[model samples]
Target: MITENQIHSLAKRWEIDQITVMREYLQILFLFYLYAQRKSDKIFFKGGTAIRFLFGSFRFSEDLDFTGTLESDEIIGLFNNACSDLNREIPAVEMENFKKKRNSIVSRIRYTPKPDTYPLGIHLEISIRERPITKAASHIETLLPVSPYPVVTHLESEEIMAEKIRALLKRAKGRDLFDLWYLLTKEVKLNWDMVKKKMEFYNDAATLTDLVSAVKAFNQKKLFDDLAKFLPRAQRKTIPGLKENILEKLGRFAVT
Candidate 1:
């Protein structure tokens, strides 16, 4: 169990709120649990959380996302075991709900430290797929420097970027745009072959030009409002201009 003091220290070091720090703490704990049960090999981490934890993206993510080939029963069992292990380590943590959907398993966890306050909840979403389109997995270290846990196996950065591009075209959420912008700014090359493959999977024939046009039509006000909650207070004020900036830079990298 990570002590409150240690979590506070980490929050200070990361310059984020204590609740966000605790969420990340639990995420690491869950990752360690998966490693302990050897189920880590069956899953491939992706999405915004992976971008932050694995590749040092500046934006903070709430849910932990993964794509794995495991069956629902197997994934549920694995999560059950992981939750049991997490509870054994930190009795305050509890798995409140486990809902099995057609293509995903959603787990809601609650951390109840005191009787006076409401428990903090965190959500983990695991998408059950046949397998990763790109088998580009690698072992990588997490951002937590003091932890001695084994390296996590996740999708490679380029593959993650491709997925981010897929997400940008598929969803209206502002975070996808933000993530793509960050990846492009870092000069991370997008794997166009993988991107095309993902598009084929969805039966979408949208080209780079089409995607750029869609991005240009995004409602800036809605984007600003949607992304404001995830950013730090100092950064929140800049969201109003983020849409324009992203559109201006979109042309530079949205190339074949």
Candidate 2:
């Protein structure tokens, strides 16, 4: 619900484009809408988007990911009601292309915050495969001026790191690598036991050597291609050395 002037001002302040600012504002606005429903605690926020909004990662993410106990219908209901409230508050915003696979247990939607402009596409994935290892903690997100401080329910730093490690090992996406590097630079501790448990789910037996090899195998061009748009121009240079930096810091977590 920010004015055009406010969006431009925020773009200048954040050193990003107005389109990204608009997308992020709409994302925060949607999260606030969920908070307004008083069921925020039922879902545990995780992934790169959570890293950006909750932990202040420098990168931007396009999707909202969560692991929750809420049934699919309940989740959909909450989203539908939130979309109604959002459209009421900002008439320009529209929710479209909603679909939930019968078996994937994930829901997807797109939000166009402004007509005849870039549509802010958002994907919502809720995994109920297993319960979260750590209890959800409250994080008060107040970065954007789009809404008042909304407390988000999310996993602990260690648990988040564990999941990030699993994601890095499995997919090795630039975003996961960047998130892990950010967490490591911040000296966030890794819960090895939790890491192992998460790995077990994927049947991955990756060791320190395997993790090192995985980092080494990352294609720098792909890394840049994956993260360049999400990062500021100045920060794009850091992508080339992400693997080395991550390996240098990763050893501290070795269980030897």
Candidate 3:
């Protein structure tokens, strides 16, 4: 049960909406932060979670995602730690035996990480990532917007980094190609491989397939071409094999 007050209360801290921002705060802890924080050296939110700080909306998300560059066991420990800490604070977020892995089955740790009962019916989750260093453009940090309700301070850079892979997935094209046009060809380009490290919800097949579609859409619409005219195009084709690899996967809604 999610309530308007509780949701609104925390989101206000970051100058974001209770609906979108609050979900992000909770998502990071329960989903992946606990696992990453313990072992990883540096971890922060980057995807849609960052967008929410600037101009994010309240559309429901498939799950939460966080990114950091750390070994695998460390990532798992981060998830565990986050669960332990949150449950301690609120005392309602029960997270025991939260990890599961099999040969051909789902590898996930799904559980409630929020202590508040908002009455809004919003569940929280998180995804972790470690930014990769390659010969590419630097990632940009845009400011997020807050809801009409006022909080303590104005919208500022988040202490953590997370994103809305859910939106990116929905807006994908041929396979994993994201809607380049939608982002207006922003100066920053996402490193898919590093991003992959943090995203645990979807399997490699699902991630690649979705990414394939997103890129195809952008190319078809000449989104990159148009943006190249204005911006420096710092995000030049960085993700190797991304253009063709993910493009092979069909969209879930292809209606075979």
RMSD of each: 2.5, 2.2, 12.8
Among all candidates shown, the one with the greatest TM-score: 2
lDDT digits (tens) for residues 1-256 of candidate 2:
5788987887777778887887787777777787678665877888888888877888987888877677777776777777778778766665554466533255544555446766567777776665788765665565567546767788888888888888888888989889989998888886677888889876766666777788889899989899888897678888888889998898776542
lDDT of 1 at 256: 49
In order, what lDDT does every prediction score?
A: 0.74, 0.77, 0.37
Where does the lowest 10-residue lDDT sum fall in candidate 2? 101-110
lDDT of 1 at 1: 58
- Steric clash pairs (candidate 1): none
Compute each candidate's TM-score over C-alphas.
Answer: 0.87, 0.90, 0.39
Worst 10 residues of 3 by lDDT: 153-162
Between candidates 1 and 2, name the one with more favorable TM-score: 2
Clashes of each: 0, 0, 69
Candidate achieving higher TM-score, 2 or 3:
2
Deviation from truth (RMSD, Å), model 1: 2.5
User: How do all the candidates rank in terms of TM-score, highest first?
Assistant: 2, 1, 3
| Candidate 1: Cα lDDT at 38 | 62
